[model samples]
Target: MKMTRIFVAALAALGLSGIAWASTAGQREAEHFHWHNAGPFGTFDREAVQRGLQIYQEVCSSCHSLDLIHFRNLGEAGGPFESAEFPNANDNAIVMQIAAGYMIEDGPDDAGDMFERPGVPSDAFPSPFANPQQARGSNGGALPPDLSLIIKARHHGQDYVHSLLLGFNEEVPADVHVAPGKHYNPYFPGGVIAMAPPLFEGSVTYADGTEATMEQMSEDIVTFLTWASDPHMEARKQMGVMVLLYLFIFAILVYIAYRQIWAKVKH
Candidate 1:
């Protein structure tokens, strides 16, 4: 059929595109990682997400901006700071306090000039620098990518991120050459990364008294990034399960009706 041919052609095109993408993405195999949020029924570990947020705040926020996230997002379900007491992050005392710590550029005043004001929960996470030029200039001419959707944007997603974070060290293969100011990381696409090793055994002191091992930080941050990328993941999965249950019940009813109708007819 014409429809069948069209579907086949579309699939062929997709396959070709995937091949092209794979060829250019990287030569190194992405290391597999197990996460708590990996499957259909999976849910986020709230405490781990909170720790990840803490790590991001203390370390990653200096170089990378979480531009797409707002203070209010931290109060939503599946988020690190989500809670029954503070269901609305916009009005939550903690979120309000965190937001107020930053100074944001705002609207024209009576004199029609731009002014700066303390941030609110409604404001976006502030960028570390004024612009890309500033960001690049400060970081050896390489602009740090935003962390907003980083877990989703990369080829291997969170696994790639986890590997890259733990992959850095002083040792490099004899044949590989790393330029000054850049670090060698085998997990990175080109085996060279702009950012240095950001994680260490004691880089962050967790308020929950959890030991801040390198692996723990990487895993926690990845978990937070995953939640940031898809805040509605839990809701979506729940809805999918409900839909499947409804379909199963409906099919059983339809089958019973079909059997009754057939019984009334002659063979």
Candidate 2:
């Protein structure tokens, strides 16, 4: 009984410590947004994803890099560039054209010098800067992080992304000090962000003619980022459904067999 009491006291202390730690983490609660890619049966919107891609290419791509994504991923099944004519994403003409637009660094030649060539469908998205120093140098000494897995990296994931993008330009509190190059965004931790207001009312012209409101852009970009973070999420959810159905049916069959076997027995 004494040991149990001690254990309980220890747990209470640990819980209090956890609360203190959470308070010190500096994370502000993000505003919630309805995501089509959320929940069990949720699927990505092709047009929204495509529009998000356009936004990334036109604006975010100037500083942020999506190092993990390849051009061909757009044309893959369930992706934005899905094409009935070209099932094989690697061979998709649109993907090839997009990749060809960028010049990638190739291997050293016979003279031991690197060469540049047009990128291919399989090539990863190229970084905006050559190195970390260059990236930071160009951006007022703030390194723009790669957006490849940002959706997974951030807490509250999708909601956080949407809020941060749309929460800019708010009135700064008297106590809060925003740096010269920084901007005020309540959704960001500590209520400040190095990135300026990226999304505007008329930022990029949507290809599908969707109104380019701040909220719409924010939602679209978050969808694309979520998909980029976990391209196989939909497939995994589908497989999970199949497995559950199989197990449920198997359990029913087993229960029926048990009843039949026990019926012939005495209790």
Candidate 3:
């Protein structure tokens, strides 16, 4: 009886907690947008990914860190900077140039002194802040989440991120009480977000002459992030297609063999 009561109490507590979470987090649904890489055969748009990378470097890198990515990854198969001539990403001239642009801290020298040097292709993208405390200090006590795997981390991630970027409302609703630092974003949990609207018209001039509209920027960034999160998506999809084709052929052969053998025997 005591065990049953304990379990019942636990269930009730969990139910209440779920209800509370729903009250806070379930306010709005993210609007779905068409993504180039949505279906099994869909592939990342190279131009969009490249544009997204530029946006990240110019704007988002100041706050968020892409710890999982290395400069060399940019030149790998299916990456935005990938080239047919350069199979080895480390040797890719474009990747090397991009890496050299960053100042990376190197190991202690023979004199036991740490020093900064030009980054190499193998080096990971540097964090904007030295530590978590510094990150929070810079962003009004809110730590900017690392965006490396954000797409996989969040539910309805692509839609959620796209929506969040454009969700900020200039006019606050009367029913909503937004704190000083927080901005009104109905799409965000609790209808408020610490981060302000990051994108605006003409935020970054596109190299390929694409117009720098907010929606275009958002879509581009999301595409880039999706690629960042799943670099092998295209390869995986291709492999899946091959596997399905192989299985289909094998099944047909097996059926033919079975029919051939059964022909000699009475059903």
- Per-model C-alpha lDDT, please? 0.82, 0.83, 0.86
Q: For each candidate, give its TM-score against the true structure.
A: 0.87, 0.88, 0.88
List clash counts for every candidate, in order: 0, 0, 0
Could you give me the TM-score of model 3 versus the true structure? 0.88
What lDDT would candidate 3 get against the real structure?
0.86
Show pairs that collide, candidate 2.
none
Worst 10 residues of 3 by lDDT: 14-23
Report lDDT (Cα) of residue 62, candidate 3. Answer: 97
Residues 129-215 of candidate 3: C-alpha lDDT, one tens digit per residue = 999999999999999999999997776778889988988854677988989988998888878899989999999999899999989
Clashing pairs in 1: none
lDDT of 2 by residue, 1-267 (tens): 864564444433222212212421555687777888776567888788888888999989999999999988988877788899999998999899989999999889999999999989899999999999999999899999999999978877898889889888678899889889988888888987889999999899998899999989988888888888877667766765665566568779999999999999985
Q: What lDDT is reached at residue 166 by model 3? A: 87
User: Which of candidates 1 and 2 reaches a greater lDDT?
Assistant: 2
TM-score, candidate number 2: 0.88
lDDT-superior candidate, 2 or 3: 3
Q: Once model 1 is optimally superposed onto the true structure by TM-score, how far is the C-alpha of residue 77 displaced, in angstroms? A: 2.4
Candidate 1 stretches greater than 4 Å from native: 1-26
